[model samples]
Target: MSQTATILVIDDEPQIRKFLRISLSSQGYKVLEAATAGEGLSQAALNKPDLVVLDLGLPDMDGQQALAELREWSQVPVLVLSVRAGEADKVLALDGGANDYVTKPFGIQEFLARLRALLRQAPAGEAAPALVQVGQLRIDLALRRVSLGDAEVALTRKEYAVLAQLARHPGRVITQQQLLKDVWGPSHVDDSHYLRIVVAHLRQKLADEPAAPRYIVTEAGVGYRLMG
Candidate 1:
């Protein structure tokens, strides 16, 4: 799969990026580079790479923050590579959104093995469809972009999270607990109010009305469903 896979490397060190580019390219994997967390995120959104190699220390923003933001709309496999070998740092990165973690000064063979393992877990065949359209609403899940007909819709991270979940399963009731756990994490599963507020905000931005809903329909104390 390395022959067709695309990997995005997000690290501030020019030497590190160059090394990874060479190593990955040697294995026939297409590589994309970004020098900062912000740039890395833009590259991830634009390229929709098969896997991401992230570094925890970044110049503009923490890599953990970048991981959290990327998780808002993408489930692409992420392997965090950082110099921080502390157990706490590893735990934080894994819990935040990383699929795997490698400390700096690691062996190239081991890194490549881990990379291959992550790629094997993704769906075979071609990459999953990145776009989902329902009526006038169009969602580019890979880019974390949403649009309603001709105009693009700007959504907060949480807003996009909820909408993306709902959009993935149109015409099906997504339980409130499920949405809470996914969008807000497990600790907030019982926090129905949080989910409600986000849904309301999502609806407002999508120009959907609760009384006469077109896109989202409330299920009367159960949950919400996206009407495609």
Candidate 2:
């Protein structure tokens, strides 16, 4: 018996909320609406939704501040939607604990795909499988071993962390701040150089070319995604 997932949509725009409600309910999702950050935060605490679709523009409170406060108490996956499409805005949201970011005027298909990707993450504390495969690459999550075909590829802990996270979400983009914060902790979210170096090392070990990368692909100013 699969119940529809509940989604908390926190956006101040009435038209946007109605659009999202209709769009989400069409797919059998239970939609909860909030017109302000305060109300949204309150609803999230009371409802404990399966996922949150948050807008960065709110009337009562700064959306970023709300996100940071929510992060302090909740680990629910947040997909940030905002009209601010700047690289810095994306970086700040991701570092502030958003799972992903989508700029406004987005295509519905892409938005739903990203939403599905966010919801697919395994819940915390469940044992991750020891063996996982993506294409020709095999990762032993328990042993922390990675191999291509029959040859083992040596990787540092940080390199393996990056690879494993991407593997967990195959073909989906993992924001740089999310990766950095997960692997190196919260303080290093802004240290883009460190993440780039690790990814470079992982690519080298995997024999992937940045020009036409087969394994790891950069998302220009956004972040990185694993290629299928």
Q: Which candidate is the best by lDDT?
A: 1
lDDT score at residue 138, model 1, on the 0-100 scale: 90
Steric collisions counted per model: 0, 0
| 93-201 per-residue lDDT for model 1 (tens digits) | 9998899999999999999999999998875544333567878999886567899999999999898888888877778999999999888999999999988898889
Q: Alpha carbon lDDT of residue 32, candidate 1?
A: 98
Q: Model 2 compared with the native: what TM-score?
A: 0.55
Q: lDDT for each of the candidates?
A: 0.88, 0.84
Which pairs of residues clash in candidate 1, taking residues 3 or more apart in a chain or in different chains?
none
Q: CA lDDT of 58 in candidate 1?
A: 97
lDDT of 2 by residue, 123-179 (tens): 654233335676678876534579998999988878888988887666789999999
Lowest summed-lDDT stretch of 10 residues in model 1? 122-131
Off by over 4 Å in 1: 123-161, 183-205, 219-222
